[model samples]
Target: MSAPSSRSPVIDTVKGLACMAIVWHHLAFYGPMSDIAQPLAPGLMAFLYDYARMAVQVFLVVGGYLAAASLAPAGTARFAHAGSAIGKRFVRLMVPCAVALVFTVVVSALVRTWMNHPSVPEAPTLAQLVANALMLQDLLGEDALSAGVWYVAIDFQLFSLSVLAWAWVRALPGRWPQQQRAALARGLIVAGAAASLWFFNRVAGLDMWALYFLGAYGLGMLAYWAVQSSRPHGWLAAIVLLGGVALALDFRGRIAVALVAALGLALAQRMQQTHSAGRTLPGWADGLARVGQMSYSVFLVHFGACLLVNAVVGTLWPASAPINALGMVLAFALSLVAGRWMYLRVEQHVPSWATALRWQAGLVGTGLLVALLSNGV
Candidate 1:
């Protein structure tokens, strides 16, 4: 195991940049507002629309890296309480996600009333609402209530699967020597990852399942393990070799992106570990790091922000290029502000207060449903 260092500003910076990119992409890729903005810079909007979604790879790799660090920092595969770990992860993700879903539901309904834009989601059904609250929309074959929310479900799946894999390793027969057991555990994990990359990842039919994305997620875990290896060159070489084989088997742009992100994170980890104490980020980088910290909240609320902005802009200007363009910019800026607000006001409170908040949110949702039914809405 390696000694932990201060949080890397670089990772946070990457996250910040990615968050901005995603918001920009969404603003430029969806709705009549984007239609107005597109003519202003068609080429740039097209490129961002086509490619900005790849930023998700960065988050996936980072998630895997952090999961490994928390669950098996030593790569010992000793997960004494995998269930507890999974429960904690679910709460951390779901509490904020559910709250965000409620916001999405309300904003979507408002937009539907104000505009006939293609981007506005339909009035959310009770079943769809329940599925989204549980983050099972993808697996349950329900339409998503919000843009980019599928990633939240995938994040939970990846964490749960990784922990369960470790638990399975821990449950293996006890007669084996400790060293042998550890080696076997690591080998099994690698095997699963390799299978995912070579086989499951190629099956488009399975994309909704956790295993479909596990290939990239596993590459992240492998990156962490490689960086921690005593035989650095050999470990890295093996990682490169395995990744090469996976690509050779079937080239996937997203997987390739994930591999690159994993390598970048590993390199950053190496540099940070080698550096002495007192390493600090410059002012701009520190600002980006703050964005990274609130990236999840930003991601969650940005759709709602965009919807509200679109309704207002459409009412006032109705596709006048300049005003809509300005609205796009306003939407982007306000998303950051709202994301920070949500993070500070809601997400940060989840650790000690999630249970209370969950109940409160449920009651609110129930009351809203009753009122809607009463009005025949």
Candidate 2:
């Protein structure tokens, strides 16, 4: 029988772990909590403040890996309707993100009444909301309504770019043989990734563009193909060499971390293939995988959760480390609770609106929920 098409617990564990760190990073890096907590353990807080964001590379790699697995599973460029693919991706990301944005805007307004930390976002202008809705906030120079939102736009750009890249490979002049086509496709992906890492990634002017982050994203794609290949080690080594060369040219700690994560994923896939004799997995692994599944929701909602908790702590005990630490714990716990609710209610339950009326109804429902949560009503 063919292998079961289930998610790997290892991947989910990585994602879940990253989600926790990201939540911690946000709380430790922003607000009066950071100022208070830093005095207790400056080194730890400093690490979280400076390097925890790099955990995003895990998601980047995972995104590319999944994109490749879905779009071009057999190691070749293959997409029939690029626009349709783009549209599906857009809706999948936007539905929940739009709801999260609305929630952020409302929560931000309420939190501003309690405290005025720099972490507290201002009331969004019409332009700001529209720009973020279009995922063009970075390009339009409008501030993001929530933390880590730029990644949502970047993920879309990377997916579109990757699809286009694969389509270009498939459309090359000659009708090459199967093996030749696969080789060509892999080569193009590598070239694009290398360009991003060695050139585009280094250019400060290009930071807002998807190309700048494609290097890490491409590594994830390469890793998926590598694990799926007959010779996993060879492909894994190639991925390592690509990352090594990029680092040798210009050392980037973020890229280095991404390289390691990509390697870990590749190795994990190989191990699963070799040792997964049974369908069942460890309980903790399964639990973490659920978190991985909810990671997008957590990323979208955690900032608002943080703001609410921080507002409470700030209002009651602005400079107290103990209270701030408690706030951080509550923020983390509440984010997971809220994120799970969001995943269930908004992300997955997003309506398959057959008409504009249905879509409007969904929006109205989301608005009502946000309003009720925002007010003590």
Using lDDT as the measure, the top candidate is: 2
lDDT of 2 by residue, 1-377 (tens): 00114266777788888888888899887777767756777898888889898999888888888888888888675668777777767777777777787777778877877687889876555566667777899999999889988999999999988787777777778768878877877787788889998899989898789999999989998899888888777778878888999999999998998899999999888788888558666798777778877888999999998889888876788778877777788888999999999888877664342432343344445445544554546
Q: Which tens-of-lDDT digit does each residue in 1-377 have in candidate 1?
A: 00123255766787888888889889877867788767888998898898888888778777777777777766656456987777777777776666776777777766676688778887666667677777788888888878988998988888888887777767777677667766765676678778888899889998788888877777777777867876666646655766788899888787788878887778777777789647888899999988988888899889989888988887788759888989999999989999998888877774534573574367348536744854578
By summed lDDT, the worst window of 10 consecutive residues in model 1 runs over: 1-10
* Model 2 ranges off by over 4 Å: 1-6, 277-283, 350-377
Error of 1 at 119 (Å): 1.1
The TM-scores, one per candidate, come to 0.91, 0.90
Would you list the C-alpha lDDT of every candidate in the order shown? 0.76, 0.80
Deviation from native of the Cα of residue 91 in model 2, angstroms: 0.6
Q: After superposition on all CA atoms, what RMSD does each candidate show versus the true structure? A: 3.1, 4.2
Tell me how far the alpha carbon of residue 365 in candidate 2 is from the true structure, in angstroms, after superposition.
14
